[model samples]
Target: MPQSAQLTPEELVEVAQKISELLGGKVKFAVIGGAACSLVRVASDAEYRGTSDLDLVIQPNKSYNAEVISNWLVQKHPKIIRSVEQFGVRIPAIPIYRGKDEYLVEIEIFDVEAWPNRQQYNIADTASNPMTTLTFSPDQYSGSSGDWKIPVMHPVWLLREKILSQYEREGSVKERTDISDLQIMLQVVDPKSLVLSAHNHVTALQNLMAKRPDLINKLRRAIVCYPVFGD
Candidate 1:
């Protein structure tokens, strides 16, 4: 028999925390990707499937020169197993191998004002819109890091991201993931929820729905309202 060591959700969150601290706590960004589901501990019930890398979207404190941000992110990443390249085009990535498996720790920094775009963001807490700071608790025993106990993006926000990605980076391999993601969002949603979700993504949704209104609309109204549960 053989034994193995893997980081838990808590450990992953700790990595995000450490990065935030090193960056002066200016990381008021939402967690994204499958890892986000683990850190926020929202989507998946299976924990063993979680560890691999940390994906972050940092809302910058000021105007972001993409070069500076990219450089800073690459340096902060844990280790470089190999240089990064995607479809002959280089991407920023580092590989980590554990036992028979190899993994990449990916860091993606996004500007707060620019990343989410207009028809996709809605986590607006009207608190004078000041630049936010960050902090995290590291628990060695649990193996979790970052904010892995919250819904990083509402179900709808994800739909919007998928929609935008589809158009912005069409024919790219990642588009397949975007399509799959949209279907998942459709599964978790219903009609009213769809509209509530679409209010921000109508531009994207309208086009998608025009093609499959029956399917999309069916989901749009499928969710049962809880307040009148007994009615």
Candidate 2:
């Protein structure tokens, strides 16, 4: 379900806001995967290449009642339809189709899963980036999103995701993105944990340069590691 649209930065923020209101105050959520770099906007012009459809990791809360969300969508939405998909869990996804295009919004809808476990580590790693203001403003949304300025990924958490994706899509071009993302993530987060997590759930990629210690050693000499700190 790959659809393209000319969305301005404000439009993206507006969508984020609408989501905020729909879900109720920015309960914990993280913009991970390709969407993470799209949101981070931390890379320079040349580095800003890969982008993907929106996929969010929502921290389940009281306001995000399953029945309530479905009911509200039914009441407010006249165009979209709801359905569930089996992806190792009873996951529900709402597809808002316009014409031949379908915008897929899938919710894993879990609580206290991996967010907290990696939050501290990610916080520590991501803190090194003092550049809060990005090309896209996460602060410009309509509803609340905690205190986030730009949509961010915790190094450890994001690394885990990359590792997981690597396992699931062993031969995908997306592996390139995952590798680049892991390279950046390791600059601040614990490299050992990143490797461990990458190998555990990461069954996708047949051979990742990041997973190769010798290749990783080569990268250390190439990619500039500018580790920063945050609270």
Each model's TM-score? 0.50, 0.50
Clashes of 1: 22
Per-residue alpha-carbon lDDT of candidate 1 for residues 1-231, written as tens digits (9 for 90 to 100): 122234555546555554444444434555565554344332332323354555555545464333345565566553532335545643354443456775555545444455545423223442212122223343443455543232255544454466656555567776655655666655554445422233434455454555445645443454332321211
Residue-by-residue lDDT tens digits, candidate 2, 1-231: 433453334444444444444555535544555655544434322244344234455444567533444445445653543444445444434454457776555433323334455433233234431112223334554354455343445555565566456656657887666766665655555434333323344232224544565555533433333220110
Error of 1 at 69 (Å): 5.6
The lDDT values for all models are 0.46, 0.45
In model 2, what lDDT does residue 81 have?
31
Question: Which stretch of 10 consecutive residues in model 2 shows the poorest summed lDDT?
Answer: 222-231
List the candidate 2 regions with Cα displacement exceeding 4 Å: 1-14, 21-26, 42-46, 50-52, 65-151, 187-215, 218-231
Worst 10 residues of 1 by lDDT: 126-135
